[model samples]
Target chain A: MKKCSQCQNNLNYNCETCILRLSGKTLFYNVPSSLLQEIEHVDEHISINTKIYEENESNTYLYSITKGIVKLSITDASYKTRATSLLTAGMSFGLEVINKSSYLQNATSITPVKVCKIKLAREQINESKSLLENTLKKWQENITNQNQIIEKFSMGDTHTRIIRLFHYLKENSPLEEKNNFYLPRLEDISSIVNVSKENCSRALSKIKKMKEIILVDKKSKIYKT
Target chain B: MKKCSQCQNNLNYNCETCILRLSGKTLFYNVPSSLLQEIEHVDEHISINTKIYEENESNTYLYSITKGIVKLSITDASYKTRATSLLTAGMSFGLEVINKSSYLQNATSITPVKVCKIKLAREQINESKSLLENTLKKWQENITNQNQIIEKFSMGDTHTRIIRLFHYLKENSPLEEKNNFYLPRLEDISSIVNVSKENCSRALSKIKKMKEIILVDKKSKIYKT
Candidate 1:
């Protein structure tokens, strides 16, 4: 290991801009203070429906959220979008820095979102043991979640997957909506359910036939009631 | 961060069963030798078709591959099995050990495989920064692969998904077979394609009709020629 003798000395571990302040809690709560001060970060505000980053871009930085929501998505060779997960306030991303990760998905702001960006340098990876641990924990959680959806649709039918997704949206609540939940682009929902847009539409129509969700705008919103 | 005074002094960083030695290379390449010695691990062999562990079983140790192949998979509430990825000779698993992770998937040996199991204690987590980093990198790669599959099939067709998955299997070569390859259990392949067994079979028939794969046995094995 290349231990930089001068790295720790005079390093600012406890700056006011510490990500934890905005995130409330984080995976690195236990990261020793001496190690924490060596890190640096910056925060920014993004508009609703903005593309934060794409899978192919190697921007060399990751984000921590202060407010709003971000949707992690992917597009295949055919140019269809699929929603991987939704990031809410107090969440952070970009663990790929430790491994020089080549991103294979797109990250977009679902609502006007406030986020903090941090530089991940080679020597600095040793500084955030907490962040790396957090990445593993969250990865497993997402994998489990995806498997449940796959299992729910094991009968090879799209209807159940769509129903479950709707149930998930109602339970999870997409952004700032007590009564006006906007369904995302059909393609996004389709990816989450592991089906195609047409299957997602068919599933949505099946739900409509059952009078479960009222498609208010005919484009995306669903009435709360 | 605890900085155990006695932790590094007597630790054994190098042993015959060392994970790095067996796996050829790993994320721990840069983990300080002092820290590496503080953690302990063991090597073991698993039989073909044997489950190394499951989502609910807390065996408390994780694996690093030395030989053979392991399938990281999940079984949904409906009893359908999905193989998420195939881990071969140079990989490791068990990031959940750091956080008492609730596993939502199962790890099974598809072929006879050798692995090193390492105990992950709270203090040891601080000691093994390299392992944690590797876990995050591998997790992201798997997630990326999954989204691509979802994206490739975004057209809402099961046949295309199966065809893509077949292409993937052929290119990736999850196991060692010269002229003939035995397709995994239909249910496992179906889960990867995110379709039901019936649909998977139908897709297979279509492929056979196209003269792409020749089924020689009562089970699903295709002739290379």
Candidate 2:
């Protein structure tokens, strides 16, 4: 049994016995155990900043995050990079399998990450009721989450956006205890919230001074007070 | 058999012969003609500023726009309303049918609108491969489109955001000629682009002064010169 070096968890690529599935925090949670056991997947431990997939690349597999966070972004027509989403454990990306189209965003791991990659053919998905249901459900949830995040950041000043972003991270983190969670790099946070790194740093300091969040371990561990 | 009062076009609720189907610009385009013939749908003519659906309401049916535009927005935690999407003809909304969940945003008619509403059950979608395929494809496109809009708007200042918003609207409008399109009210445009109405108007004036866009007919018809 190989162990995941990043999270130090014993790694099993099988879906049926996976810890994320056991904890009921995976995209396949609704899938029946029998079907889960029949599914074949590969688990990969990705180092920080590794490119999981590139925009416009051929998307052949759907990826489910097992540990750590991944930033999904795209370089727009103006050559500006904007973060579209931050997917953590239990969420999935590379949903272009449904359309068999190219990836629309570049996905890169923001932390040492573990992902379960499943090659889900469109026909295979259409054949399995549970899998199709779960896929569409995740797709809907992803859109809703993105919309909410955009709404949150669009409504406030830089500091307010930073505060809302932290609150959002705290709410979405998969940790059993939500008091503490891994914070992505300042650059990643600034990109996600559409603010400059300096502005984000200033906002973070203000938030800390206001006692909203406590950053420890050189800002890696963020605690919501 | 009836006429759509909003667009002044002949209306047919049947999926097989609908104009949007022939134009290949609808969510159900890929469904088989046999299945399309069997599907029952309703055509509705909605007045301007009408609330099509409220956020968190039970989502039972999916709506395909046949004419005009609709705005999708949500009130954030701070009670500020943020527009998430602006859907024009041939686009669809109320996608929560996939999960049988509540609507995630409040959808309102930005102009006199016509929609073909379909009650799509999850089992019905799973039973038909093409319908499921089309639904998933639309879902993927919707997310991609939303992300691109967010990315484009996040790149620059208020004027830049408004310009990007118009370019987006021009690209998305289903008119046969893209040289001109209906510009939503300043309030709607401001909300959609995350700027104040005053700021939006000021930016529009600057754009007009630079001849980037020509606003005509009481600022309703916007022409790209």
Candidate 3:
């Protein structure tokens, strides 16, 4: 088993090569390296369809995705589930702990996933400048992303919404893997775009006829044309 | 003209009586009174339909509403304008400067409005603990609000969307004025809810028949049944 050089731990990912530490796109990109060393984190592998956390669960740690995909969703008062976002490698979730005690949404793994869960101390975050700034930055991005999704999906018809969703997914795919993007199942995509599964399939057919997206695997992989 | 006791300034709305300082609903409610005195601001009464700020304009000062209403909106790439949010008395705008130098949305007065344009120093914000925490709080609320608007309006049908929008407007109405809510024109409400004007009118009529909302003015004011 390979060991981490910085923390001298027998793990696939450690503080030195942690996605939060290595990826500039992460919420902790600007957080000081020394401060990261002071924080405690562990890498864990989970199978597909596992619920990482449930809504209203006490938020105590920040989850960073080192591999695979995770879907964040919320169940409305009417009992309808809506997917808010899909997090891939280098993206982090659970920063809600910085401001709120409970998770506002359910995070479920869409694929077999690897995550580095970092234990967060409220006192430590309040005292650190970089940590606070990064947290605020994450908040800013969160709002911007929500707005983008609303504009892209809500304003358009089903077909238009599907096209826009594909573009967004392509743009937000893991930094290094841009050409061939990972797509969730059609049922999942339907939920994210707020449409029925049949309508989503119809729209996908129309979009495919237009040569907008070429489905590589007919299930999970797509390449933008 | 009344004089502000704190700054000895002859202004109708001054630091001593500023909405930001007086209202618990405001972003600046927790900011120290000593810091409020240190900040520079001016009271400006803008005419209805006046543009407060343009999208992409350099953000300089935080605009706190002392009276009346302001609509914040964004124009997408297709030139379609969407109303993102409506700000009323005690609410503030222009906090986007905390993370970025440019305003992401346009702010325009929906009614004859009074605003306290408080000059913000980026360096000062970074230096103060309370200011940072408040800013973070604002961001958290922003995300929560966006998600709420999405789930409420985006997921449901046009009729459902209008009902949800009314409930949201009722909930978000100026703190003291809950029973009688000030609503914008049907045209504006239609845009905010992402529905066509005709459809919005139709759904509103249905809602009105059901006593979901009683239109007091047949235009601007509504009473929830």
Candidate 4:
């Protein structure tokens, strides 16, 4: 873990400067500078290798991915794991605690990662009314988009579903072009789409042949075109 | 539609009196009376047979269910319809448009309904920024809850999914011990679970036999003991 030289603070997540750089064009565009200062006190740094949150454990802090990717996944009574979504730099996670007592899923860092943690209590949240409202608004928008993705999977055919997913990723990507995207592991994608690994491979191959996307490797990489 | 005798305004959605009655012991108990007044407004009343919004339509208003039930649903490109969730008295809907250009689903009155519609770009929302912020916070919480339900359907078995749904209703319902609840048609429930009508019926019957719940009719009803 690295520490901030100026404030002598352990720096695991992005510094305020880094957040300004990554999210400046998107969600951070309209946030007032004074409001950013309010967040400064709440930020704490963390570093994790590979797996992070354990299943069925209490989660007390929310994290913003600063330098790497994290996978949020859930397991059933039979111990079958299903990946729900992926969080990368500039995205937030661990908000399920607002509705439930404990984390329902396990979140693991897909790579060696740095995350900024914000400790929140209900009373503290109630005090920072405006900031809390703004955060909740962003959270709601993210969940709505996720629900739409689930709806597509439930209703659309495989080809249509893949197309929809591609479009969604392209529209939402921080990158300039869909073809230049950073893809997650094939297993993670398969878990999200609820398809067998073999099926996911075939689907990817089919799409690749059509020039819809390009796969860099059979496992952990892809580039959409 | 009946009008409020006190103000001669259309009495639909939750009136101030109704809200006071419902807020007795819920999470909303501490919401200030002045804040409630600030958020309250007259809304149009719609009959149960009327459709509040159509698939792919541009939704321009946000609504709070006051007197009856509403169903939020969507149709695919092939015109297959699915109910995403049901909203009852005291719950709000149509918030997906907050940051989007248009709505992703259709909302309809499941029973003769009264809904207080908020004009997001005009009215009290603009004048009272704090009130608006609070409203958005509550709306965001609702969306988060909806996402959890979607996640459950995507990952859990039919039985577990049903249990989760029942638990959610029980926890959120305004009335305790009166677990008898009203919902849309059985086909609507099938759409939400992404299962065939026969499969949904079988699942419900299985749960009923297990003493988990009882259906009062083939459509438009459900109850948990």
Candidate 5:
């Protein structure tokens, strides 16, 4: 494991504290300390820019964001793509690889990013073992969150839906100041809410006019009033 | 655990072959045989006419159907109830307990139901553990099926929605069919499709006229043509 030079931090990732703050549970809770030690030995840090996983490609490594943001997305046959969700510092991705051989969604870094990659073949992690139960629980939460989004789309009107999304971000986003929680690009937000970009733009305009939310830096950042 | 006297059958809640078939690769592939042995010990058998869990009551058990059918429903304040899903032999229920302290749905035996009940106190059988990974995979599949139902309601027109429900039942129902599977009650179908009883009735009439489905035993049962 890469240790911080000054503090000699032995952990594989820095986001554990932030993750615990957001989830009230750490991903490494059930992980055996010995196994963590083993992981620390083999963990490698990689830096990548822009597109990371190619379409229809199999992801061989599980990644945790160490520095910047990663965007997860899926594309249709018509080449229309939607951002599924976003991963940032301290968050993990490529969990869908646990059940399937290939990655179902594409992940790309929003900025030059640092990620700690763990090779699946390096460790014999059993999906059914208690050693990884915490990880499984994390995945289960992800699935539930996805389901909730589906429910919101199903039950809520457009304005209600947008408000629900805002509420969700406010509740779950790592940033404490509502204004510091940077919103994804308009296209990414459109894909997540299952709205056309024009509709998403219109909805944002309405929300801004109503003073429910404010935009900053030419609409790249968003904050609640 | 209950055992059959003559056949020496271990009365576990899951039919081994049925679980393997239904869960397919999702849960079956990575599960170790030793983990399966642990699951076999956790099985509890209950007889017919038994109430497993009541609506709004604290949920304490995760059940799998080993022998007979189970009727899962929810009751409102007025005691007006609706069946959500009819879990047949080998299907699992009582998953609402995962996120909540109580059950949202009530479960009762439809036939001489034999269930393998996993008690909440047993830390030995962690649902997130590798031993029950197959079981969790099956549960995720159930969630996916639920998502499809929600998608149907969100995106499809009424006629198309009803057709999708029919198709879903035809694909997932466990009942044996010479020509077509029979749905025993309108209320059960209505709940699954998220349609009103009246709408289900009207849709049935339309489908019958289209020769897409036929009713059996008045309105008590239905079969696709």
Candidate 6:
């Protein structure tokens, strides 16, 4: 079994705090603790669906989630929102601050989110090797995720895309189950998959009939083999 | 009149070598000359359609083209390729070396490509502040490009996507042309627009009928107003 996020115990239980401590995959992962301590930070609590930052507008602060999910998205000229990626605990948002450019995507709270907002400074990034490395690492990870999404869309029908979408959510979410887990609401899933709500529902039903997903609740389910 | 790539004079000639020196928007921009000179580098010549590197596999050397075009693409499970971005002169490739992970996109030479391949060494990166800064800058530029792509697809129809593709190419190229430019094969345009070849052809014909484009040669054209 894979190691647990919190205690590394390899047991199934809701360990929400595990995501916070196991942020080895985040920007703070390899940074010097002293530097982290010296930085200015604010603890922010946001309601579900709250807008954290708008694309190409905000650049004052960088953020790291301690609880809940933040979905990074982009809106076209027509104001069509495309879900770029999901930011769970340990993932840092507002990373474009390093380049001192405009935000590339919008950040929105997917659930009730708790985040630590840090004042962004170029000096901090210049002096910290670990910080720069982690930022590049995250950028690389985002690129990989984008390619994977493109891959899914390029080859799959609606049903296949929906299955991959669920697999994607489970992969990004905080772990608590072996085969069973909860997901964002259908609308969120539809936004990520870039399909209509009806199409998304149809795909979900198809997956259910195929015995690929066992419904545990309206938003929770099992990835049945 | 637009400034020439080499002499800054208004001219109407192809400057094949001009892009090599005019790289203000690339990673090498703002970097010290001595640091660049100290690095071990090799000049490589790639034929058209040569595979520079495959996505999710190659991580051998970092590359920057001096001439021609390199298209970054992603191939799905069914081996269908979608062009993600164009890496022109000054723009670099093989950046996944920073993350020490798999490549996020395939780098394919769309023309006869002149490239400088460098073996990325961590010691060199850690010691030079310039290298790290340039890399970060490139990452930020890439994020911006990705957002632009998302914006284009999300907002516009296929015709607009084709127009934006041309605009994007003009923006990234070395020289500024007011109403004329050469393009890659229709297949390349089709790949970039994520549309079928017949659809791309239909869009091209529509634009031609709309007097937005004037056919010159098979690959060269005039963007008529």
RMSD to truth, every model? 9.0, 3.5, 4.8, 6.6, 7.1, 6.9
The better-scoring model by lDDT among 4 and 5 is: 4
Per-residue lDDT over B25-91 for candidate 6, one digit per residue giving the tens place of the 0 to 100 score: 5555545666667666656667667787887785668876776678888877778777767767766
Candidate 1: RMSD over Cα atoms? 9.0
**Better TM-score candidate (2, 4):** 2
- Candidate 2 residues B63-103, lDDT tens each? 99888778888887777667777777888888886588898
User: Comparing chain B with the reference, what is the TM-score for each candidate?
Assistant: 0.67, 0.81, 0.74, 0.65, 0.60, 0.73
Clashes of 5: 6
Name the candidate, 1 or 4, with the larger lDDT value.
Answer: 1
Interface RMSD of each: 3.3, 1.9, 2.6, 5.2, 7.0, 2.2
Error of 6 at A192 (Å): 1.4
Candidate 3: clashing pairs of residues: none
Error of 2 at B199 (Å): 0.7
Q: What tens-digit string does per-residue lDDT give for candidate 4 at A74-141?
A: 66434556655655666666654543346546787654455666554444334444444445555655
In the range B31-98, model 3's lDDT, one tens digit per residue, is 77787777777677776667888988986777877777777877765667677676667767777776
Q: Model 2 in CAPRI terms: which quality?
A: medium
lDDT winner, 1 or 5: 1
Superposed Cα RMSD, model 5: 7.1
The C-alpha stretches of model 3 lying farther than 4 A from their native spots are: A1-23, A44-50, A65-70, A86-90, A110-114, A126-128, A170-178, A205-225, B1-24, B43-50, B65-71, B86-92, B109-115, B167-179, B204-225
- Model 6 chain A weakest lDDT span, ten residues long: A9-18
* lDDT per residue (tens digit) for residues A1-225 in model 1: 222122322323233445665343543455565665566665566766688888877877777666666677767667666566666655666656546876666888755566666665645545565654555565665555445545654344687776665555555454566544556566666666657677678878777788777766554455443
What TM-score would you report for chain A in candidate 2?
A: 0.80
Best by TM-score: 2
Q: Chain A TM-score per candidate?
A: 0.66, 0.80, 0.76, 0.65, 0.68, 0.72
Which candidate number maximizes lDDT? Answer: 2
Writing each residue's lDDT as its tens digit, candidate 4 over B150-201 gives 5655345677766665665555443334665544356666766666678778
Q: Report how far off residue A23 is in candidate 2 (Å).
A: 6.1
Q: In DockQ, how does model 3 score against the reference complex?
A: 0.37
lDDT of each: 0.60, 0.75, 0.69, 0.57, 0.54, 0.67
Give, for candidate 3 chain B, the lowest lDDT window spanning 10 residues: B172-181
Which parts of model 5 are misplaced by more than 4 Å?
A1-24, A30-33, A40-57, A63-93, A104-117, A120-130, A151-153, A174-177, A185-187, A194-201, B1-57, B65-116, B119-136, B139-154, B184-204
Which DockQ-derived CAPRI band holds candidate 4?
incorrect
Residue A166's C-alpha lDDT in candidate 4?
59
